[model samples]
Target: QFDQTIDYWGGRPHDDAWRAAAEQRIAELRTAPLTIRVNGALGAPVPGATVRVEQVRHHFRFGTAAPAGRFVGTDADSERFRAEVARLYNTVTFENDLKWHDVNPAEQQRIDAAIDWLDEHEITLRGHVLVWNFEVMPPRVRDLDAEAMRAAVHQRVTDQVGLYRDRLYLWDVVNEAVTNTEIWDRIGWDQFPEVFRLARAAGPNIGLAYNEYNMLNDREGHWRRSLENARRLIDAGAPITTFGEQAHQGVPLVPLPRVLELLDEAAKLGLRIEITEFDLGGVDDEEVHAQYVADFMTACFSHPSVDAFILWGFWEGSHWRAGENAAMFRRDWSKKPAQDAWEDLVLNQWWTRAAGETDGAGEFTQPVFYGRHRVTVEHDGQTVQAIVERTPDSPDWVMVSLP
Candidate 1:
């Protein structure tokens, strides 16, 4: 098994330094001060008004890789999957439906339905991969000559990216290029950046990301390769906007400190880093899995350059490593310790809710987690509510006028 091959922290003394640093950074970077102002309909300040601020969503993207089969099907499992997704995540990436091999005419219908559901929920969708230089190519692609393969790839990128550009927040323009070099060898390394150009032209407004695996552990020098490839692509005029690290870990988990170090190094590229595919597949103990999950999430969340933390899968039945039980929930949808840990952090520990009476200036000010908040004020037997987004770029104060 893969677990036996790597070094682990098994039964070793756990250090609290990394956790402390993460907590400090989370407080410093994830919060902002906001002032809520209340006024009467005629523009008089309503002093001592009761004010409440409740966060409705997170600005940071907490996401999962969703299987379209479950999202679009009518089965009980599908219902459960969709419910959990809507409850737990604000962003999603289709597991296999958006990949090169699966984007056929028949699968497009299912993809459309899934996109519709995501739109209705207001969840952000990321296109999994526009190009993966792996063996999962269609039969026609396997035997094509160099020129024909280039043409095929160009057409595929144009068609798929143009089709869903409006709905997607980003696209993995090229995936795992560090290790999977079939396309690189077939089309020449010089043309790799052109693929990103194709995606940029097709999806003018969406972000383009280059995704790779094994950067967290770095047993294979994949992190260095990713950095080198990123520089090459950028130097050659690829408008790469994000760096995607598929943080798939097994039994001997990479230490939290090392993970943070790698993140810092990746952030040096001046691109937003995403923990694109995170899952604990190799650990046997549930408690260990949960702790690692919390630590990994904290490390990622603490980093200012990190934009999103996405789970590879959430349920074991639909998980890629289903045999190893790498998900937070079982096939029956029962919660695991990892799930509890995730919820506690995402919903309770990191969540923001505040209530207070406005001052003589009719202003209530507090530091809050950055996100959309419903601000409610009550005065003179009248209640007024307004939704405001508390981003770094938002104005200093929000105004809610009472009737």
Candidate 2:
């Protein structure tokens, strides 16, 4: 069994049994082979992304051919993009802001293009947002009467959510809605509720998220108001499955205590929570940036309610705040120190992996004892390790193991 230590940080030392199981799991992991699986149901794979399995390297290539466009003009060949995406990201989120613009220059075509590209690459698509108060107002709606404006908003929500319901798994039902408290108060809280209702009506099984920013400031009133809004929504019967706190402000300003408080409060609502838009910034010290990310992720995953974390944009070049250098990867696609920290703490250190002798059918089955383990494999004098984590609720890691 692994030795256990009880520290003030809420982690207990591993007991003997736990240690023994971990050692056995580690040994098994050291001998396992590797395989990568792509699931079209999960959405599009981001191109030019790199994934590491301990010391082994895997590159994700998107299969979609490059279109004759400004953006695609400089991109890699279609087949190469496909292979690279397949090797890198397990999932991809469709860039949909342009589709929400009032006079979207390429509206239908752009949406179709993204969908087609993802389909060809067998990538899953996530409809970024349904209602972003600052971004979606058409000139006509802006000039319309209050009632008409509300109707327009409702229609927009219904149309977008309904149209993509079958293809997208999740939607930022209302992005940054709470930030404009005055607008919501004046328009009636029902305006937001209606958006949620319309989205659910359009797509029953689709996951809905309420995404926002500055949630980790540690300001008492801010935290209280955020939680109160969530409670109010749940009380009003909105089909809100997730609460997304946008961590865009970057490290130094985001108080750890406040993040924990937000998680704890949100968990009470019985909804899954996500740090949907995370970007670490400002601090040039990579180590500090990484530690902050590690600590933040540890707190987030440690919470029972958080299901997953989606970085706003993984690379600096594509980040909304690209000029500020707020992403895990630099513009050149080289990972920053924060990236390593995240990989180590969240992906490797917190995950568990194991390998076992294959049966006559070249299949191996082993029960991964609870908690995180690193599985390794030694082939032809070289060793590789894969990280896996055990959650308190599920025992199934088979699907995760293949990737």
Candidate 3:
């Protein structure tokens, strides 16, 4: 109801009388700031001149999910883990808090602390797995008959999702259920869409996602059921916003061409394709891991459909999967080859920084990433500075002159 009422994209124009009156009032008061013209030059000092303003940092969020239990500590024996996380990722997903069995008293403390850190940093949050029966289930709910389980599902959705209502931008409405009958086995496959519907109702504008693994290597029948399941949920009026594939690879990591092919197919769904749980493991050689990470991340980011590439966890100490091959970071907090590869792409290659001659009218334009930037204009050996905000809605040019 709220989204419909406050439709930002296609909402009706402002009331004509209100707009006319506002324009009239604005015209009556001419207090708008005028441009400061520097006398160094009559026009752009450089021929074919244009001022260049490029967003060096991407607004696109790079994120990861981790266990909250790793965050609680104040002694010499314990380290400030969340502080380390604050240095890298811009978004976070609680690895355990959103699950049913893990929402106990002890876990709640950790969950609260994680939320505080996220809020303090103003980081985006994705709530994972509202009703994932395969991963972990409350024992009581698991053993119940169909009717009791049905009630339990709805109740849990309401309880947990409702707790973070209007806060989480996305939620894994039903996880890995498309691959099996865990959820539909109890609720009936015909009513499987109910989980998504309940989640949409529980979390209003939150993105209800259908997250599953093996969607990429679906040369077999791996993706058939999941694809059809997504169709069913969409047709049934479930406000599914994003589709996720847990990209965890071992010995046989997904081929780059195959992953790109899957990305094309996922784009057909008309939703954001999130590589939610991405990890390239099962290789002892860090160089191999680094190359694989480079290829995998390049494929995902290059594709137009893919939105985010969130690693499962960064450090081996906090990683749920155990192995030298697993996770992006080593035990001593040193960057692995894989981490270096990813950082190089995001920070060096993708980072937009450019120097160019300003065009006539003392303006420069370039399509760069969306973020904050500082534009410096040089004319006649004097420099003038102005802040440039590159955003999606308004990303074009920055104007500057000598003061």
Best by TM-score: 1
Candidate 1 or 2, higher TM-score? 1
Worst 10 residues of 1 by lDDT: 1-10
lDDT of 1 at 92: 97
Residue-level lDDT tens digits of model 1 in 6-68? 345654444667888799999999998889988888998888999999988999999999887
Given candidate 3, what's the lDDT at residue 289?
A: 72
**Candidate 3: clashing pairs of residues:** 49-358, 49-359, 50-357, 50-358, 50-359, 51-358, 51-363, 51-364
Better of 2 and 3 by TM-score: 3
Candidate 3 per-residue C-alpha lDDT over 29-137 given as tens digits, one digit per residue, 9 for 90 to 100:
2112112222344443343333444443355667888776655667432364576666666777878767777466777777788677677776778888777774478
lDDT of 1 at 355: 95
Highest-scoring model, lDDT? 1
Candidate ranking (lDDT, best to worst): 1, 3, 2
lDDT of 2: 0.56
What is the C-alpha RMSD, rounded to one decimal, of candidate 3?
Answer: 13.9
Please, what are the lDDT tens digits per residue for candidate 2 over residues 269-316? 788777766666666656666766666666565555666555666556
TM-score of each: 0.95, 0.68, 0.79
